[model samples]
Target: MTDALNAPGGLSRRRLLTAAGALGAVGLAAALSGCAADDPLAQQARAGDNKNYVAGDGSVTEYAKDTRKPPVDFTGVLYDGTKLGSKDLVGHVTVLNFWFAACAPCRVEAPELEALHTEFKPQGIVFYGVNLRDEQGTAEAFEQSFKLTYPSFNDKDGQVLLAMSGMVPPGAVPTTLVLDKQGRVASRVLGQLERGTLKTLITSAAAE
Candidate 1:
């Protein structure tokens, strides 16, 4: 993003970490190289192996209707101290974003998520964040700075992450999942978000 885009003091202003690199940049990718240390893609990035892994490339992937598996159901506490679960997400499409307060790419995608939330929320799609790290205060600060209205789960104990287990795995620190109305995992973006791709996915999911 340009300096103008990162400028502060507006309703849409972003008080992002200046030192953190932009999404899809080599520096930003390097920072998350081990964000999920055991994740194969992260390992490849760290080793400079350049294998099948396109680490932090901001790719958006949607599962074919037949390919989508059963819904992911889990429960945890939100930053506001409220309880949330898969049952709570049913009947409406939902977007689950995995992030932490200090992750640069997470900051990069915050506004986009907020925009999607603003657009699709009126259509009844719920947006929630799963924070793999950081305290409540930190997460709330990031929420305020990003002007995000969606509630985020506090996964500090890994309850939410553990529930997602093999699927999405929290391997990529900044991953997003779009759940269909039935609560099934319909689409996933494994790294930094692509705004246009996400909008299309959300739009399609909302229509389903």
Candidate 2:
């Protein structure tokens, strides 16, 4: 993956991170090496949970204002063919969840995500799903099953993921990121979301 990312016309890790306003080179090195022994996602991988996906332990990281990187920028086409970009998110709190239809945790969290989207929409907050592995039909089916109102990006080619490579792990499904009004990542949920916890995270980011 690293090699491919650095290949011609591909995004190198450093360049991607820098472009997305993610942690700097030094910080990226630390983050890559700092996976804790007790991290649920790591433990699940080693244990062969057979869940097919490593579920996050609902861990959350909130970045302080001074420590936040620059605003993130990327362009993507939503399922409905609507184009969305970082500029669309400016001055608004945004939530981006990486998911595919079959991920169990994603299925479990869909309703909650939608509820949060509805609850916060009037407050000028936006939510978007970055569908990593599904085609438009499958993604739409999942959304219909959950009755989700917010639109999702069809990230099949990994363009959105590539843009977000620094902050999101390579194949970590069900990861959620909260971006502040300035478009910088303000917080993140590593696994399945706990509604109250995400709500608090969103509320805090909105407050800022």
Candidate 3:
């Protein structure tokens, strides 16, 4: 897989992290290394690639909830007090990112996430964030510091967080979920992702 990503016109997700390391970054190594096949993050990525965000039996593994819809609807709040819900995002390809302001890993990956959001948003991919285990003011401050342009939901009590199958267990910060236009959980990327990998996901989901 590393070889494949390093091939011509290919972007090895790990290699990208290597370059990111020279810049004195944090958590990029764990984020990228864990993304390899056989790793927990990689398993989720493959499941998503196979359109198995919902398990083989059509059930969410960690969470007991089952969905009749391809993509389940979610509702919460933006950092600025605006409402965010599945209905608000109808007819769009949405990349939902679960994060927390206090998580160092999440903070480290914010720039790259923001970059993907900026690059693909104009192409019809919308980035919706779920800020978990933090106050609205803290989440809002993080957004301001990062100059984040995408809208994010505040999961202060973790009710919304607990409800998300892919996001439950809270194993890691900065989990990503790609929802197709028809509202299916097309891809689930656990932990942070490289810009190239994220772009490819957005492109594929938008095409669907």
TM-score for each model: 0.72, 0.75, 0.65
Error of 1 at 171 (Å): 3.9
> What lDDT does the true structure give each of the candidates?
0.69, 0.74, 0.59
Candidate 1 residue-wise lDDT, 81-108, digit = tens: 8998898888998999998866655765
lDDT of 3 at 102: 54
Error of 3 at 93 (Å): 0.6
The digit string of per-residue lDDT tens for model 3 on 126-183 reads 8888877767778777788767888788787676676676433464555776676766
Index of the highest-lDDT prediction:
2
Query: TM-score: which is higher, 2 or 3?
Result: 2
Clashing pairs in 3: 71-183
| TM accuracy, model 1 | 0.72
Where in model 3 is the C-alpha error above 4 Å? 1-69, 166-168
lDDT of model number 1: 0.69
By lDDT, the better pick of 2 and 3 is: 2
Considering every candidate listed, which one attains the maximal TM-score?
A: 2
Q: Give the runs in model 2 whose Cα sits over 4 Å from its true position.
A: 1-50
What candidate 1 gets wrong by more than 4 Å, as runs, is 1-55
State the RMSD for candidate 3. Answer: 11.0
